[model samples]
Target: MTSQPSLAKADSNPSSPGEPQSGGTGDTGDGLKAGLKNRHLSMIAIGGVIGAGLFVGSSSGIAAAGPAILISYALVGTMVVLVMRMLGEMAAARPTSGSFSTYADQALGRWAGFSIGWLYWFFWVVVLAVEATAGAVILNGWIPAVPQWGWALIVMVVLTATNLVSVGSYGEFEFWFAGIKVVAIGGFVVIGLLAVFGLLPGSDNPGAGFAHLTDAGGFMPKGAGAILTGVLMVVFSFMGSEIVTLAAGESEDPQRAVTKATNSVIWRIGVFYLGSILVVITLLPWNDKSITEHGSYVAALNSIGIPHAGQVMNVIVLTAVLSCLNSGLYTASRMAFSLGQRGDAPKAFARTNERGVPRAAILGSVVFGFVAVWFNYQWKDTVFDFLLNSSGAVALFVWLMICFTQLRMRGIILREEPEKLVVKMWLFPYLTWVTIAMISFVLVYMLTDETGRKQVLLSLLAAAFVVVFSVVREKVRPRVDA
Candidate 1:
């Protein structure tokens, strides 16, 4: 836990207990610490963008929309880029440890910030449960000595200790976890291109032709409806990308970190996601039997000349799972710590150790994480399904708030600090509103579907639960007089 000066500014005092400590480049002493470096921030910005969802779920998009699934990814990725740009603009200017949550408090209101903070925390903690199970399952497959649940417990405990050491330890761990995924995807793209170009072991198929794409019902298996239908799933793949901005708040150079990350997102969406998926569809038939069973990328590789396809993908998927767990722990614990500082959660969460990491917050998140692991393996059919189905819809809520905060923060910056406009959201107000409307429509649609009904219900219950707690806390002690 190598400590540095608190980044809080003079006017920005320690966040009142249970409130987000305004990370004003001036915070100090046991409250908040700077243990992460520029490289960690940069890699987190880059590596965290590619999530396990892309590794595991995008194949469904491919099957549902076929070749045109690429279009769905493009559409969603574009929106994510625009929304993140808006977030980066505000985050670069203020650069608080709270990230979007703090911005919501300032731009929206204290209540809004509190609600979103807890919701985001809840969302990631759910992910921690899901991801930890995923990592454990892979381990169980190889070393059958430990039952799957046992592997899950081992994973959660190890990561908890890693996070306890220092924020940098988590960063270093994530850097490599993310690095492996990057390498795997990068390798996939290269091999995919080689296969497509008639350069691989089996050169029977021609390179870059339309047959694989258009042959099976012309690239829209279920028609335009399916392309749109796949959006729900495709959009989920982009969820973890925003984690970098959340994490940037703690880095050595907050503003610069935000700018670099925001700028790099365009390429990540392009190359890692769009570019790679494009290669996947182009290399193999959209309706290939391997896809539905073996996963799109590994199946594609297997269809080609690659050996050990399943094990290779297993390694990549495991890396992705670990990366998600690593980032999830970091994101959730910070939100808890931020909430504690803001007076919304227990004050102990805000208590930082000598390394400046929030020890209690990390452990608290891990506790539920282990519980989630239990639910996953024990209640595989019922509890885990409910957890996965119910919580994913909330990601839109968090992204929407980020958009809202940026909309208001734009004016705040223009009036007070023009310099921070270093990273601007393209088409500002117009595109911003479009993304919001689209997000709103998705949420509304979630309520209409029969299967989606429960998801929407649980999601609203969660959000409303968080909002109510925030309001009650405010009533208990009005900050104006406190």
Candidate 2:
């Protein structure tokens, strides 16, 4: 990490008519130039969308909604596509290292900037903690000698060092990490579809038809209620998808990179998420008790008599966990750096080291990862559950902020430089509002589900915390003299 922490500026005083304007441009480090290539960004878009959660957590969602759970993936994927389009429009214009948070500040207000920036920073820091635990669990399950905590410690320290080197290195690292996941999941989908058609090595079990959808209990075995429930269940798996936009800020051609990634992200998401889920459902009965009993993809692979299926899945899940942790640390550090630059966080966070890494932000995020490990180790069931529930519903908050920023930013683009609108969000405000309404409905439905209710409640508290901070800071800042 850079010794000079790159944080948002501490004083968010807007440039007055007579005052000289400065600061708020992002990533001041020197070791790395903006050199993230298009290929690197493309793989990130493809691989980042398919998180390990799809393989593991999607099982519970499938169990809840039966075969129709494919609808849940389709629904959430569409929402994200619209959201990303909105984000793409703004990013194509500004292309700052600070990403959405800085855009929120410039478009919405200083308060919106600070709140979203810090909240996003907080989100990723917590994710670092959570992902470390996940990676540790997989490693421990595989080796059974080194404790999970030790493995987590190793993962954190190594990734921290990696981020501290340079942004280019981090991009390169994520490129490969994401590439492995892409190949694995993509291959799984192909193999799964083949097995579904009864073309695989063993065809004892009838899998080559849509009969799996209705074989056990028809499409909505648990009723339509569970499909709404499945919406909440599968949404968070898409969390890492937004990181591509953040990294694009540091790319050599931010506008071009963001535009290309944004344009293709929807189809990529549809293929990876909807396509993969479709294969899973067609290959196995959603109502099969084993679907709910074991990890989703792992269980299905076992059904197909794949050799070393569990171990293979354990490796894949472990890779996804590590990739997420690496990205989480990077995201948190960059946000804090942006916050410092914007005058919302301590100024030290804005400084970057010789290698152009945000040293303080990286270490600070890693410290949180360690703390989360302690909580996971000590409380195991309850505290872990609480942590998961609290952050679960904030996916909407993050996405909504991106959408709103884009709405305001679009006008700014026309007034300033219309040339940058090379990549645009289709059906601007219309799709924007539709997306928001869809998110709101999901929130309302979540409030009604007993399981998702906990997540909704915890998320409300988190948003309240953000709102209170924004209000207090707005009140405390000195008024500008005319």
Candidate 3:
């Protein structure tokens, strides 16, 4: 066995905020360029809050909790805000492409970093397959000449090439893709609200009014407990909210970008998530048969007399899917690049090309993504089901780790360099602990339901295997000074 490296040395203070640390800047470490502009980061942060899940997966939540699903969304939104605050606090102190994983190395241990890093990478690659397939289905519907799998292949290849070219290319594509989503949803909410207030022009369904919120069985139709069930249903939709923090590392000003994204999270969640969902439940009754038949958004549009509502919503949903696929490839590659830098992954993943793009890492991630796409096509129910379930709970795991890491990192920052603490978590250790408890409760709650139970068990199993591998790898690998 190789000698073990001192975790204490790994825990040493990060470099000056301006200087590139192990995982920061394009100097003396990974050659990733600062290609993302302020506008790109702005749109990415705004777009991060809206996911295809909100567009596609919300029907089930409305079906389950009725109008009370609003509470579930608010609860999850609050949790995300708190978690992002903690992450922002750290990222601002010492900006790095590694983001939370690097913080995990400093505050927890190498094993923690290794485990979470790989799990996060696994989650996104799987998501690439999911988003690619989703986009393909929509494209195939629009153009029946191409097979679904052919569309999937074409989408994956195109996005992978965009990422391979430069981080800026990814940002440019996302800027437009996300722009469409933001505009589409924003317009929906405005039109829906106007119709609800009986102010819409040429509208047949005026006075949608607030009655739908309480009329049919009074909000908590399934009972207050259903709110928690709704939480499980809608929680995963919030997955991409943290991608901005990861993307911030590649921007011109990492700390400023991190702080800005962190600060604006609340409003983004409010306007996009809570605001849009409110429009849906209000514009039509939560229990309306059409809500489930045609989806919440489309049903709302149809109620407002919008022609071709299904087709319009499909166009928007397809944009959201493509955006997700683009971001997923970028996120997975960066995480792999970080792991490679720390000697946790193959060294080739750490190398970059002339344009400062992590070509090897991007290709590596896409290769697995392609294999996953194949699995999706070949044995969707058995193999792809396991992949989906095992990666399902990772968002919760990631949030839990952020909460824990913040608790430790706070004191570390104070002891070493207090000024670096620009973005503070509200209520200090108290709110941090509360956030941790809330996440743990959600995990435990997942056990009681059939679908949630499978996701929790399989995700836990996947986590356990990674943790064990990390520990064993630490023992065998040669110890090197940080």
Model 3 local distance difference test score: 0.88
Question: How would you encode candidate 3's per-residue C-alpha lDDT over 1-482 as one tens digit per residue?
Answer: 12223334453322222234435455423477888988899899999988899999899999999999999999999999999999999888877677888778778878888889999999999999999999999999999899999999999999999999989999999999999998998898898889999999988785758998998899899999999999999999999888888888788887888899999999989989899999988888889999999999999899989999999999999999999999999999999887877778877787777677888899999999999999999999999999999999999999999888899888888777788888999999999999999999999999999999999999999999999998988888763443
Best by TM-score: 3
State candidate 1's TM-score.
0.92
Give the range where candidate 3 is weakest over 10 consecutive residues by summed lDDT. Answer: 11-20
Distance from true position, residue 74, model 2, in Å? 0.4
Cα lDDT tens digits, model 2, 402-437, are 877777778877776788788787887788888888
RMSD of 1: 4.6
User: What ranges in model 3 sit over 4 Å off?
Assistant: 1-29
CA shift of 226, model 1, Å: 0.8
Worst 10 residues of 2 by lDDT: 1-10
Candidate 3 residue pairs that clash: none
